[model samples]
Target: MRYEETAQLENPRSSVSTDMMVGTALYTLAIGVFFVVFGLRKRQRWIVFWGATMVVAGAAYVVAIALGVDK
Candidate 1:
């Protein structure tokens, strides 16, 4: 499925609150940062991959909120 469609499907009820959405976005961003830092220090490909993935996830979460999918 497409990213936007997947997001909509995952959050079908649209009952998520602003605080919860913000928290999830923050958590994902933090994880992304951690992975990027660890990847740079340890030179692990997986860490970098996870970091990029988290960044995308964070962006998607924000987009979903902006699109009013999880209101």
Candidate 2:
């Protein structure tokens, strides 16, 4: 039997970019708005909750970007 090991970098470079963060936030915001609109039209409580959650996620991403949060 052969065993394989995956090498991990000890010191990794942070590849965070402004464009990526903004793009993700914008996409999330769009999804949230869509859900909110459809939820309102359908009068579904769960859908509205999901919509709110997505909206918060989007806002959080934006705030993290602003706060320089990165891995």
Candidate 3:
């Protein structure tokens, strides 16, 4: 039997581009907004909470990218 090992880099380069990241962030923000609105209409507190969490995360991701945190 032969054993194979996977090597991991200390500082791996990200293949995701700025445009792709922005697009992903925007999509997440949109979904969060949808969840928040739907939850409000349905009066679901848990859903609202989760939606708000997603909103914050999406916004933070955008801010982080803008600040060059990815680098």
TM-score of 3: 0.72
Question: Judged by lDDT, which candidate is best?
Answer: 3
Screening candidate 1 with a backbone cut-off below 3 angstroms (N, C-alpha, C), the clashing residue pairs are none
Q: How far is candidate 2 from the true structure (C-alpha RMSD, Å)?
A: 3.5
Question: Cα lDDT of all candidates, in order?
Answer: 0.85, 0.88, 0.90
State which candidate, 1 or 2, has the greater TM-score.
2
lDDT of 2 by residue, 1-71 (tens): 98898899998876977787799898998899889899999999899889989999998988888888954
Error of 3 at 19 (Å): 2.2
- Colliding pairs, model 2: none
Greater-TM-score candidate between 2 and 3: 3
Model 3 stretches with alpha carbons more than 4 Å out: 1-15
Candidates ranked, most accurate by TM-score first:
3, 2, 1
| lDDT digits (tens) for residues 27-47 of candidate 1 | 998899899889989999999
TM-score for all models, in order of appearance: 0.61, 0.67, 0.72
Candidate 3's clash total is 0
Worst 10 residues of 3 by lDDT: 11-20
Candidate 2 runs further than 4 Å off: 1-10, 13-18
